[model samples]
Target: MHMSVANVVIIFSIFSSAEPYSGQPHIVFFVVDDLGWNDVGYHNSYIKTPTIDMLAKSGVRLNNYYVASHCVPSRNMLISGRHVIDIGLQHGEIGYYPRGLPLDEFTIADKLKEIGYATHLIGKWHCGCYSNHSLPHNRGFDTFFGYLGSSDDHYTHIIMSNGLADLRLNDECVGYKYFGDYSTIMYANEAKNIIAQHDENKPLFLMLAFSAVHKPIQVPDVYMQYYKSTIHDNERRTYAGMASCVDEAIANITEALENKGMLKNSVIVLTTDNGGGSVGNNWPLRGRKNSHWEGGVRGVAFVYSDLLPMDVRGTENSELMHITDWFPTLVKLGGGNPCERKNLYGVDQWEMIRGMEPSARGEVLIALDTTRKASEEYRTGPFKYDKFDITTFAAIKMGKWKLLTGDSTYRNFWDMPDPEYGVIDDEDFDDTRMVRLYDLVDDPSERTDVSEERQDIVHEMLAKLDGYEKAAVPPQMQTKPRLDNHVLECMGPWID
Candidate 1:
């Protein structure tokens, strides 16, 4: 179903004949933090996501979307149209060297702003650190109302970073703490206000990046009441409640858009920033967040728009899509030519969203989670070679064939305190440390290994991975990721 360069001319005729948006289409990116594969209602989980499910039903659902396994890198790719490896913006963004997004790189907001679109970012801005020019306001957002660092206490809005508040309105720090007001609802109201007060003269490009369901697993008592019986684990139950709050927020935003008569003429993108953290279930997929597994890197994504052809809506797309594609795709949607702007690694996926092509991408340099250990990966065609230096040495996937070289006893993650999944596939056994291979098409769970029989395929894929490793730029962080303590010191005491 992949389209060739020759079919470009046919696109105009199809959309031109239909009733497209009267003017440039408004876009609202509803992005969440650490949402799991099975977290949403669409995946048949306990989590009630009626809003997300309705959006998916009315849009083109992308089933095989992928993103970086961590936070900062994923945000960087979505904004910059380049992977961390290519840009040298690798892990340890909490307080690593070369913190925040690079100044030279143009964010999606920056491109949208050039075309006279009103740009706003209303939530977590984790791509940069304090005092850096990479903050949302400095990087082309017309207005910013959110936190400026990694995960902060939702209720108090206080971060471990010097105990200062993280909330802000534009460059000025606002009331980070709201003793009783739920952060999710407060954010939802802010987005609703943005839509209500929007100037219809110009198209809107809004990124509502919510910080729900990340850590501290905090949720309002009312929201938690719904999942008390369904989820027994206290942390998981609270996490589900947090996700529900996010769901309600999305519903509110969409209703606001509809109320303002922007729904039919708008394009709304819904997804998580990355794979789920601990209280999440990547069920049916292997591995968790912080590691390069199907569960960790593959994320939930969807595009809902009445502007899209009627036939394409309510359908599923299995084509590959990386988080970086959003930068160029949104640029094109906002009436800007990304090709004419700067050199970019992402291709314009505007055509793909319209169901004109299968996928514009064939490969991706996934990520290198460089905290205390290394979780590196690169995928070409159907083959994915994941290299985790501290864990199992390497994992390769070539269509039906998957090759594993070793195993790791240390499966500890940042969010989860205990090893809860138990010894997977007897992987704690001595045999897992040796070479192995599996037919992924038949056994997606990777329960079988046929390395002894497929020695040739294993060698070929390993050679390909070696080439990628040589060209990749190692992460700049010389030390482990530490808490950012000087954020408030760097950001002045200007509470709004």
Candidate 2:
């Protein structure tokens, strides 16, 4: 069913009446890139982040939030209340959907706009390209100010705003220059300007997606100097500095809100697109981004609202929530109902945020694959069930019992394969790999394999995993490998 442009506008206007705001609560979604679990001050990092720490202290911290192991998929889940697989986005396919989000699908931004909120998206929009029919403007946002492609040099930024190209600087598109050494600073400035000049009569929904601390490793002199003397490794030092810059930007945003007297009436949510990058420390977790391990998918998340009261502040929630939950959560908060036409995988977390009952949501399914092969895991309650042999499909963490299917063929912090499991040490760290399980409650680091001792539990979890795969949307055909390369080339060279 295709609606005319005029019809779309009318429908949007009608939805806006659903949430009659004498002054509807505003939303500021601050999404960072490639941030680790313990990289910020609240997470016990050596780096200083006074701003983010304050947000955590004054808000609610989510201890068990999860996202896809990669960026585009996670963002897809975030915008649409469905798993990445359900939308034909899996295994880090950049620009997979050339078209923007489907028109039939409803988004948090769309729901907010229905209620008279002015929706805006600024910064990295990796969800799709500008030519795609689902650009930010078409997806219900009133405005868009950011780059269509992913990862660019901070010094020379390439941005697309409101479906236009080569945006003007002082009435001229040429000689346009980006101001800051970091993209975080530029995004922060745009957000501040938008907030300051916004019509106070209408509530706002600003999606501030920062492309900081992702790659190409760039940082300001002040931040670099501050971290060089404090952090140990060169790579970690660069990452820490970049993260600090994001914290500073958040400070500027909240301060602007408070000055406008909108802090109490606003909902601020802070989270990363996915897990940490190569140089990150997942800490007590198991794997890095792109892996099925807890470290790769688990992320740091928090929410702050003055309407909720102070005694409820700084509460830690261990509910099982994922990126897909955001769409439903936001829609409900903005006084808009979720579209009931199709099944949505996400559950609204508003009740959880209100310090209500523990999350009834259960069992997150994760899949990883190369061009020709695939592997999957089902995490329910405290157990993880795998498909391949314990060795061919290694690294299962069920509470304290962590099983290594085989030795570490990958170079990671935890080395040494269990000899008792018939997994020997090969030069590349890949041995015949047997299914060896350990009781993690006793050996938290996965040093032993107790699979032989606890056959009943292992079998039960395996059955559960089997059921999840049968119910999940089947995997899609892998797209061409160089799609991301082509996108980068089209965007041209990064300035800095």
Best by lDDT: 1
Cα lDDT of model 2 by residue, 1-496, tens digit: 1123343334323332232223468889988887777667887657577778767866789877777767877887788787655665654455433433445677778778887889988876666543434566667777777766556666656433212232212212321455343577877888889999887667889998888878867777677776766665676677788887887788777767655756657888998877676766566555567665556667889987765555567788777777788888888787887666767778888787768766747545444222222233322222334453332332333443444443333423331121112212223322333344556446544445466678776665455444544554544444453234433423322221
User: How many clashes in candidate 2?
Assistant: 12
Assess each prediction's global lDDT (C-alpha) against the native: 0.70, 0.63
Model 2 scores worst on lDDT over the 10 consecutive residues at 415-424
Candidate 1 runs further than 4 Å off: 1-19, 96-98, 176-180, 368-440, 450-452, 477-496
Q: Best TM-score goes to which candidate?
A: 1
Number of clashing pairs per prediction, in order: 1, 12
Give the CA lDDT, 0 to 100, for residue 211 in model 1. Answer: 87
Candidate 1, 387-415: lDDT as tens digits: 42323244444455545443322222222
Tell me each candidate's RMSD, in Å, in order.
Answer: 8.1, 10.3
- TM-score of model 2 (CA atoms): 0.77
